[model samples]
Target: MENHNHTALISKLLTCVAACENCATECLKEEDVKMMAGCIALDRDCADICSQAARLLQRNSVIAHQYLLLCEEICRLCAAECSKHQHQHCQDCAKACMECAEACHAHHEPITQD
Candidate 1:
């Protein structure tokens, strides 16, 4: 990836992580938290994966491609799940997830295969 893309992707990844964290936190406080179990789980997973992916990206790791693949899938899933609800946090998270997924997918190509 070019320097610009790398920077943008990292920003998107961090946005995704923050969104996921916020979504999960809000989901836990929902009246029917049990109904959001899956969403919460996905949010946590997506956040963690995006965080790791961002760190790997910063280091220009060859294996970041794998992390991007995983992050894209999880972010998409989390977005879909979040979109199921009308909560503001979930909606925001959905947007962030979609953006992150797009960035990750766009830059899925492997770096130098060290």
Candidate 2:
């Protein structure tokens, strides 16, 4: 991958991590925490995957592309869950996840062996 493409995708992945963490924190503060359980769970999962994907890509790991596929899937799921809520944080998270997923998809390529 080109340096520019790596930078762009890594930036999006980091942005997604921040958004997911913030959304999860804010959701916990909501009065009906029980109702936001799904959102919170997804947010955590998305954040973890995004962070891992970023790290793998940063080091140019052989499996990074494969890992990104998983990241994209989790981001889409998180976006869907966040979109179901009316909170501003949820909306922001949804937008970030969608963007990250798009970047991941655009950058995805056939896995190469070492």
Candidate 3:
């Protein structure tokens, strides 16, 4: 990836991580927390993947591309789940997830084995 794309991808990944964290906290504050089981689950998963992807990308690891793909997949799933909720946090998270997924798709390339 070029320097510009790398920077953009990192920015998107950080946004995904921030969104996931906020979503999880918001879910915990829901009056009907049980109703947010799916959202909470996805939030946790997305957070983990986004965090890992960001770390790998920061290191410029070759495996970062693969992690980016995984992050995109997880973000998409999380976004779909969040879209079902009416909470403001969920809406914001869904938007962030969509943005992250787009960035990931835009920069993702197949990893080549050395």
User: Could you give candidate 2's per-residue lDDT for residues 1-114 as a string of tens digits?
Assistant: 434348889999999999999999999999999999999999999999999999988888767887888898999999999999999999999999999999999877665567
Q: What is the TM-score of each predicted model, taking all chains together?
A: 0.90, 0.92, 0.90
Q: Using TM-score, rank the candidates from best to worst.
A: 2, 3, 1
What root-mean-square deviation over C-alphas does model 1 reach? Answer: 2.6
Assess the local accuracy of residue 96 in candidate 2 as a C-alpha lDDT between 0 and 100.
100
RMSD of each: 2.6, 2.1, 1.9
Roughly what TM-score does model 3 have, to 2 decimal places?
0.90
In candidate 2, list every pair of residues with a backbone clash. none
Clashes of each: 0, 0, 0
lDDT of each: 0.91, 0.93, 0.87
lDDT winner between candidates 1 and 2: 2
The segments of candidate 3 whose C-alpha lies over 4 angstroms from its true place after superposition are 1-5, 111-114
